[model samples]
Target: MSLTKAQIVENIQNETGLTKIKATDTVETLLEIIKSSLADGENVLVSGFGKFCVKAKQQRKGRNPATGEEMMLDERRVVTFKCSGKLREKIN
Candidate 1:
């Protein structure tokens, strides 16, 4: 199961003995920091966690699956995550 933002706040509160509101605020602030950094095209690397990257994609060709029609895909920026080695080992 995927962990939600609420779960993260709960975990932080439980582990640090922080109030729920404080934990929630901290989590939300950290998330906003990461989001804003990515919005500015910067990579965010959290130690022992993972790295978040923004990648630019060029415009290219595409095909419709059912209709077999050709189309053009617009260029875009995408967010990608790379798990840290420590996290990968822990999961494994």
Candidate 2:
């Protein structure tokens, strides 16, 4: 099963002996910081975890599934993640 945000908060509380509210707030703050950094087109790197990068994508042709019509997708910035070697090793 995929881990949810609530599960993360619970785990943090268990490991750190923090109250639920504190754990939730910590998780929320961390997420907000990461989000804001990404929104600002800045990469976020966490040691032993991963790096989040913002990349620009070119406009491309796309198809509408329902209408079967061709459309042009607007260029946009997207966030990508590259996990640290340590994390990759642990997962393997």
Candidate 3:
């Protein structure tokens, strides 16, 4: 099952004994900070969990299957996540 923001906030509140509103605000602030860092082309590393980096995707040609029409996919920056080896082992 996928975890939602509400669930994350709840978990944080339960673990830290923080109020729900405080937990929610903390989670939101942290996510915003991470997003800002990625937007600024900076890498974010969460030790033992994963690393998040912005990667440049090259422009490429793609075809629409229904119409068989060719289109140019524009180059863009995307965030990529690389899981730490320890986390990978735990998952496996």
Top candidate when judged by lDDT against the true structure: 2
Residues 1-92, candidate 2, lDDT per residue (tens digit)? Answer: 99999999999999999999999999999999999999999999999999999999999999999999999999999999999999999999
By summed lDDT, the worst window of 10 consecutive residues in model 3 runs over 31-40
Q: After superposition, how far is residue 29 of candidate 1 from its true place, in Å?
A: 0.4
lDDT of 3 by residue, 1-92 (tens): 99999999999999999999999999999999999999999999999999998999999999999999999999999999999999999999
Q: How close is candidate 3 to the true structure, as a TM-score?
A: 0.94
List TM-scores for all candidates, in order. Answer: 0.91, 0.96, 0.94
Q: How many steric clashes between backbone atoms does each model show?
A: 0, 0, 0
The global Cα lDDT (0 to 1) of model 1 is: 0.98
The lDDT per prediction is 0.98, 0.99, 0.98
Instruction: Judging by TM-score, tell me the better candidate of 1 and 3.
Output: 3
Assess candidate 1 and give its TM-score to the true structure. 0.91
Off by over 4 Å in 1: none
- Ordering by TM-score: 2, 3, 1
